[model samples]
Target: MKYVQLFFIFLVTAITLRAQTIPYLQRQGTATQLIVEGKPFLMRGGELGNSSASSLAYMEPIWPKLEAMHLNTVLAPVYWDLIEPEEGKFDFSLVDGLLKDARAHDMKLVLLWFGTWKNSMSCYAPLWVKRDLKRFPRAKSAEGVSQEILTPFDDRNRDADVRAFQQLMRHLKEQDGQDHTVVMVQVENEIGMLPSARDHCAAATKAYRQPVPAELMRYLTQHKKELIPELQQHWQANGGKTSGTWEEVFGKSLATDELFMAWHYARYVEAVTAAGKAEYPLPMYLNAALPREGKQPGEYPSAGPLPHLLDVWRAGTPSIDFLSPDFYNPRFQYWNDLYTRSGNPLFIPEIRFETGDEAKAFYAVGHYDALGFSPFSIESTDHPAEEPLGKSYDVLDQLAPQILAKQGSDQLDGVLLDKDALEQQITMGGYVFTVKHDFTLGWSPGAQEEQWPLAGGLILQTGPDDFIVAGTGLVVTFAPVKGNDLIGIGRIDEGEYIDGKWTPGRNLNGDQSHQGRHLRIPVGDFGIQHLTLYRYR
Candidate 1:
């Protein structure tokens, strides 16, 4: 009797713990407030390849590598063809294997659903869908050539995708739902029609010639500034009315035509997402392939969730939690700015997984207050520990708690220092600081002639008089803006991280500590440090 009672108690406790864990999802605002375990959670994720999770043999060696990078979430894909090889035959084996491995590794999963679109192409549709031209139709070019796009107008295509997604969601809810191993689901992989902006098929053209939907016109009128550049230009050129036909309201341009097709595509996908969410309401997000400047639709990968199309998408589709950016371009600041402009929460699902841009990760977390940031192909690196990207993530993992608490507020700030430009000014905790390059401060000019060191730092205000400064190759100074009594540097605390803990490496004293209320570290490398200051004459 006693053994049975103990076992029952243990089971209840595990069930309660699992119930408390909230799946982290996107929230609206400059500040990211993801609720996980019923509290605010921040994501530190790494994206795997499209089909990397299909083979257990290929995934075995990569689990430990992911853990070493301090990743809390892994972004893996569920291929449509693999899941439904034949018509009406759905397989859950690949998904089950992925869930099992993720649970074994003690990690959360973000499942990418590779359905109608993958990288602006319909390459991931099942063999039956691909082979059958009558049951599931394809889009056509302006020249009437057939393209490999699954038509949104096709009921069979919609039904198949919805059925497959619903099954996946229901199975996850039955198996891992209790444990909550799967945190979120991506509805489709960059859903867009390419090689042509708007499908020129009879069905698509008939629908395109119809009047603009009332909801989209209202959305454009209400949020005019938030419209995409191309859409905005078309609307303004045609007098910007909210009550006209599609061509009259949006103008008869290729941009408007693409928007029409994109609206239907987003609506179709939203229907599929709504069906899946009915079974299990975990957070669902969609990613966009950004458009290049001076590139027209189909010329550059045009349609997937760029800013102008967002209003149309949002008005037409309500099932999606957020639209995220996949970062392969160098304009990190510009893209992030656009995604967050409409109070949409920022969550970078994919970024270039290079070693040098580790500092940008800090800015994404500390500066933008992003819900989560993930780099693509996380398991591709051989030596993750020694690599700069790994090192940066290691530091972020250590500082996650503090970062979560004070991000988006003025209490925290970070810098990504480059060799070409070295000066930065930041205001935090009632002090304005001017940080200069090594050469600007009259440091040995030879330091510039030689390989310049890579350095970045994060500053956080712990209390009214207490602050922490952690990073490499930084010299900090403190001065009061208003009064003299509130302006003096007191001490410096430095430390290194070992086995998931901060061990004090060194403490600067005397001249190194105070020179007219300024604290400076002449030489430092990859580590963390804390500085304590007092207001005095």
Candidate 2:
């Protein structure tokens, strides 16, 4: 009996170790794929509160909520001030608590290092560092007035950040390293200097006067056609020089100055990340504060990893994996389109948790091929089941396995319908569809013209002749793609979500089923349906 128990213990230990290990991040086509526990893992994560872990008393109540939301990973901020109140002394109780609780809940974590910047401010720096301006100076505006941003030129700031980050990494390696609770680390939380396009400090001035780095210039020249649209347009309209100083090459404008600041800031954070990765090399990424097109530098958050500064950031920082976007705007597709250029993976770390916009989540996961999407303040909702956002997440959780399998393949498509936009069309697996608003052909004519009903749709092709269409507020009609003829084989109604298992629902084979190519749910509500078809002459 003792020998048998010992053998079982050894088997369990080996399996645990194998489940915790992960490899460095690499690019798979246009997407950044992470190898976790010997499998290709896509991050489906949410950003927790910045100070949520400081006291488990606060975080304990929210554990059950997160787990129920079907979140695989959580993005939590680790403040430098709280972790290292003094210069060299480091405290990691908060980080330890986060790791232990995350593991207990069977969730992975992405630690956001709130070091040099947090939302374009140095508010997260240690009190001692923030108090002593001489040791760790702040950036100044063009008028020589100090701003809340930490100067990238300050060696003391960089050293303190590196030391704190290294200690955090070492602790993670020792404690959760074997279990791999933490999969990735974000170097800094939106590092940027705002309220001014360029710093007027002496050190900043000196650096700005220097010529543009040869590597960055080469990248710009080589990839000019693929540059950020606004930047490329500016350069092309201004002679498009391949070699010169920053002003001479990119043109002397507020946009150019902001790009210059981004280069310096990215370089500084890269150094900090490199120091930490030396101890335990894991995948690391950076987050950016996006800006509007016609907005000025100060009008919007500036000096971050916006697309126009992609060249500077790519050339300045190679240690980071990819730059992610935090969404607070309505133009989800447009912003993601800009960020995904040059083969960058799309990862939305934050978005508004509005009940009406639930369908956007589906579009992000299915249509856009985003690695992950998290709606901010996820725990704040009092009744998740009743909320549209929560219900959408529930459906997504049900379909996660299918979605994961078809992530890189062309087997899925999603749509987000607005009140003004009443129709959407998509093609998958040799079938073309024209899906309209549920009220398009039925109900009162005024209903279709009234406020748009918020709805989402997802189509998955199981086989060449089989498909499943699921969601709300949709009227689907299918036709063959080009030369092939499609005939309806049968319809599966009374969809069964069997014990969290998706099997074929009961067949609705009668007059209820149309001639196979056309089916309509006149008054469509929240539901899932499977339509099986056959190819014939």
Candidate 3:
């Protein structure tokens, strides 16, 4: 009897723990958080270059490099061709290898499913699917040329992807579901239409001529006021028709063609994502290849959840948690603003790996309340520990707890600064703060260079008069939000968080705070400091 009771207790505890550990998203205040093991998680993350995770032996040395960078999460690829080399038989060796290695390094993962499409091509599709063209047709250009991309309009193509993705998700559930090692899944890689805005295949043509789906038309009618400006203008220009073919409703143009393609692509992804969620639900998303400046539809990748198409994607793929951007362009703020609108939580899956990513990470998490930030080609650096990003990550890792606690409130914000945009004014905790790039001091040797290094940091107000500032190349000053009362720096302490506890170091009062004129973290320095402000007449 005693043995049976003990066994039953163990079984019950295991079941309860499993139920609690499945990763999910929850809204806290104005922000959304990725909750892992029942607590909010911030991904100090990086994405491996394409093909890095294909071979375990190739990834062996990369694990320590990631650890050195203090990345708690990794975004790696799971190739459809590799997993389903033969028609039916599946090999999970690569997926298993990634899970094993990621576990060994004590890191979580966001697996990118390179199925059906990658960067607008069917490059990662299984050879069997590619060769059996009759069984699996290709998307055609306007001139009737069969391109390498698979047509999403085809049931066969979508079903093939659906099966492969289903198997992968089911395997994850059986293997790592309880462990929750894989926190999220990116359904496809930079999915888009190219060479033409929309597919010109016979099936696509038929669909395009037919009246727009009532579901989409209904979505437009119901959310008319809430639609994005770009989309709103496009629809209104066509008299906001209640019923007609794609051209009749949205008009004849590249923009309309792109809109037509966006709907099909989104529905295709929705099918795959819905199937995977049915097997083992995980928070899934899609990433877009940002459009270049002044590029028209089809001149770029056309459409795959770009901001103007957000309404279409949301209308199509309710199962998808969000859509993200893979950055290789400037205007980080411009792109992020669009993605984060309409209650979508920002999570940067890829940015060009470069020097300024450290500062951007702070600005992203603090300013945008971003769930995470990642740089692509994370392992290319030779000196992993010495990398500036690694040092920034060290401070981020220490402040993760505090950052999470203060997120979703008015007390938290971030700033990104450079020569052109040197200063930003922030109002928090009944005080005004002037944050500027460290070079604004005009005394630094490199201040006069042609270009200034990117500088940024996050500020979190811990109390009415106290705050925590962390990042590189920033100087901050505080003043009264109202009246002419002078603000005085009561005290400042350079510190580090040891096991989530703040350990104060220097009494940065006289010179470090510049004789109470300002509180600064100079260029090339990455650390945290506590500051308290007082009012003086």
TM-scores, in order shown? 0.89, 0.90, 0.98
> Tens digits of per-residue lDDT for model 1 on 226-258?
676756877788887777667877777778777
Give the CA lDDT, 0 to 100, for residue 465 in model 3. Answer: 95
Q: Using TM-score, give the best candidate's number.
A: 3
Candidate 1 versus truth, CA RMSD in Å, comes to 3.4
The list of candidate 1 runs beyond 4 A from truth reads 1-17, 24-30, 222-234, 419-421, 435-457, 471-476, 479-487, 496-503, 509-524
lDDT against the true structure, per candidate, is 0.75, 0.75, 0.94
lDDT of 2 by residue, 216-291 (tens): 7777788877777776787776688876777887788887888788788877988898999987788888887777
Displacement of the residue 430 alpha carbon in candidate 2, Å: 1.2
Ranking by TM-score: 3, 2, 1
Clashing pairs in 3: none
Candidate 3 lDDT for residue 456:
89
Top candidate by lDDT: 3
* CA error at residue 375 for candidate 1, angstroms: 1.3
- Report RMSD (Å) for each prediction in the order shown: 3.4, 3.3, 1.2
lDDT of 2: 0.75
Model 3 Cα displacement at 172 (Å)?
0.1
